[model samples]
Target chain A: MKAIKVQALSKKYGEKEAIKGIDFMVEDGEIFGFLGPNGAGKTSTINMLIGLLKSTSGTIEILGRNLETQKEAIQAEIGVVPDESNLYPEMSGIDNLTFCGSLYGMRKHDREKRALELLKIFQLEDVKHKAFKAYSRGMKRKLTIAAAMMHQPKILFLDEPTSGIDVASARQIRKMIEDLHQKGTTIFLTTHYLEEAERLCQRIAFIVDGKIVKTGSVETLKASLHDQSGLLLKLDQNMANLKQSLQEELKLTKVEEINERSLKIVWPPDQELTPLFTFFRQKEVHILEAKRMEPTMEEVFVAITGIEHSEEKGGES
Target chain B: MNKGIALLSILNKDIRNYYLKPPNISWGMIFPLAWTLMFVLRSETEVDLIEILPGVMALSILFGTTSMLAVTITFEKKQKSFERLMLAPVSLYSLMLAKTGGAIIFGILNAMVPLLLGIALTGLRAINWPVLMGAIILIAVTSTFLGLMIAVAAKEVFEAQTFSNFFRFPMIFLCGLFIPIQELPALIQPISYVLPLTYGVDLLKVAVGAEGILSVFLNFTLLLVFSFGLFRYSIHRMERNWMN
Candidate 1:
């Protein structure tokens, strides 16, 4: 079953289009990642899908129902963790979780027990009694996520779930997301962290300038980049005719002078590396070191979008 | 049934998080008590507590509801906590009801202090207990709804407070609180008809027999209309601001 389906979804802000007719879907129990930079309309799409903002055009279906007319029913079964950690500042961690459960109509005892369970899962049990205002940034993020899951929703939308947190917390949040997926919950995650998306998402979509430039699984995206090749070599000496000779002998496409001692070359997927090694040896290239490069998600992002991948270290801060 | 539970939960959190706090109580009490004190001090003869009771009670609801709603809504908006409530399974009506309901509860409680104090110290009494309750309840709802309208229009806490004062301060002087409506200039008399506080105070006056500028039925009808009208406007503003 498809947990979510969006078709020609568009949002316009006066003279500017924020999301220009994008289409996508998330299957039940699949972790689908929407990857983009700031102002790329990632949050706009999420907001529309969750019924917070009405789209200027197109339609959305969630949990086998129309998003426009069935918002309350869809909302009941879908948990959302917005980018901001927005729990009540004065309420304790346990109280915040319980309050969120109460919003979903959980019984008092059930909410209490669930709050305790989630507090423990998020490693917030020790500080459960402390006011949310007193929590560290990382703890606050974890608690916000915990509150979202208090009702055990079947589908979850996490917008930068691990943003602005310490590395340990980010890792814990990622692990929790994996656990949620393992437990059969469909997930829609939007993030700027290329590595996180690469690690967790079964399928990834690259959105740029209010449009989806590419969408596929990690392997599929990498496979699409197979035609574009990259290789790295370290040498003791810089050859004057390196680019020309490599082009002539090994049919190398693009050669970049990385540094004083390193060079990067683009070779076709069909081209054999043994010929390149032979060409280097024949040309008296020192060839101190050599490495074959597989495209990183960051590289894939930069290639498809023509935008440099400059996310904050450890996600968002 | 489930939505009723959710509504109570929202009310419970609001009361526990905002209304029950000492600072909130003190803030609500300070404004009305200060006004009462100023009236008592400036009087030439013995202060007629009954004469000013309606004004004090009306102002209590106005100040209390506006301040509470403005602060809570702006804070929730800034922190993004209100989104969670909007995303809940309950209707926007339920959420608005819970928020305004909480503000009304706080306003009534805050108003009670001055009313009880004046009754105890100056022997003021309500001639019709049911009418007094009806007037206060209706005023509380109207005031809270007006406060919500201001809060929805504002993006920040200070903005909410500033916008509230723009409406509140004008009503204080124009609503026949300190000066009777008949004594005001002929030109400004029509403005009192449009201000909900005028009807609110009149209802209070009729209930306690201080003076009835308008009949009981007229006062209740106007208050009811204003209450429902303000409520409709607030909900419209909220949907435009958030649920769009």
Candidate 2:
């Protein structure tokens, strides 16, 4: 079952289209990553899905309920952590969570118990009594996440969850997300951290200029590339002459020498590797190490989008 | 039921924060006391001081409701906390009601200090307890609604301060606060009738035995109408500007 389904979702701010006819689906209990650079409609798309900003034209279904006609129902089933910490600074962390939980009609005792458990999990128990204004950036982020999870929402929408956290905290957060997924929570995450997406997400959708350009699982995407096979060959010394012979004899596509003792080869998937090894032994090429290379997500992304993975500029406040 | 729960939670949180900080409590109490002391010291005669007592009390309520409310909301806006409230399940109407209610409660408490001082200093007597309660409620409600209007319309803290003072100064001056509205020119009397603070001040004076209860009720009704109209306008503006 699809937990979140968006069809032709578009949002226009004045004359400019922030999200133009974007479509995607987040399957139940799956970790879905929404990938995009700055100003690439990632946030706009998430906002529309969560009913924060009305869509210009489209349909969004959360937990099989239409967002337009059943916004209250949809919101009740989903949790949202906006890009910014939208907490009451004058209130304590525990107070913030309890208030959020009460919005879902949770009993005071249950809400208090849940809030305390979450505060301890997020390592905020010591500062639970302190006002939110006194919390650090990482602590505030953790508190916001805990607040969202207070009701055990079925679908969680997290926008840039690890954008500003330290390395240790980011790892902890990733582990927490994994735990939630294990408990059958469907997560829809948006972030610029491609490496994080590659590590955690089961599927990813790349959006650009208000449209989805690509969507697939990591392995499926890597397999879809035209150049699916790579070879890393380490040769013994004084085997330079065999490189030219192997290229001519085996019809290799391209080869590059690495450090005068190693070579990298690009070949088609249909090509047999055993023949190359047999030929090398017959000609006595004196091979040291030869292994197949798995493609990284960066290469797959660049291949699919036709753009390099440069860092996003201009931080959003 | 959800709306009620959300409203109570928000109100309780606001009250806790307001009281937990001693500085806010001191400021709320001292502003009215200082104003009363200044009025007594600056008067040339005891009769003159007694005449200014009602005005000083009204002025204290105005400051407590308008300036303090505006500054607090300005800070919330700057911190983006108001946006957080908008995203919650609570209706905008309930949120506005909670905000206005909290501000009015604070304003009434602030007004009581100077009110008690005026009675002790001038030997002012009260005829009708019900009428006095009604008038106090009227003044607090109207001033709180007006404060919300200013808070919602202004974009920045400095802008909120300027916008509050722009109307508050004239309202305080012509509403029989520092000067009696009847002593003003004929053309200015019409202006005073339109200002909510004029009705508030008149109602307060009547409540303290300076006038009849009937006159106080009349002014209280006008202030009620002003408050209802302003509350509606502020809610509309807040919904339009922030809830999108």
How many clashes in each structure?
1, 0
lDDT tens per residue, model 2, A84-146: 888888779999999888777677999999999999899999999999989988888899999
Candidate 1 error regions (>4 Å): A234-253, A256-261, A273-275, A286-290, A311-317, B40-47
lDDT of 1 by residue, A1-317 (tens): 68999899999877899899999888999999998766788888889988888898998999899988988899899999999877899889999998999999899999999999998888899999999999999999999999999999999999988877899999999999999999999999987788899999999888888999899999989878886667788987876557777776766666778886788888656777788778877878778987878778887887887767775334331
Candidate 2's C-alpha runs over 4 A off are A68-70, A88-91, A130-136, A228-268, A271-291, A303-307, B42-53, B180-194, B209-218
> Which residue pairs collide, candidate 1?
A164-A316
Looking only at chain A, give the TM-score of model 2 against the true structure: 0.83
TM-score of 1: 0.94
Q: CA lDDT of B26 in candidate 1?
A: 83
Candidate 1 local lDDT, residue A191: 77
Candidate 1 displacement at residue A198 in angstroms: 1.0
* lDDT of model 1, residue B191: 93
lDDT, model 1, position A119: 86
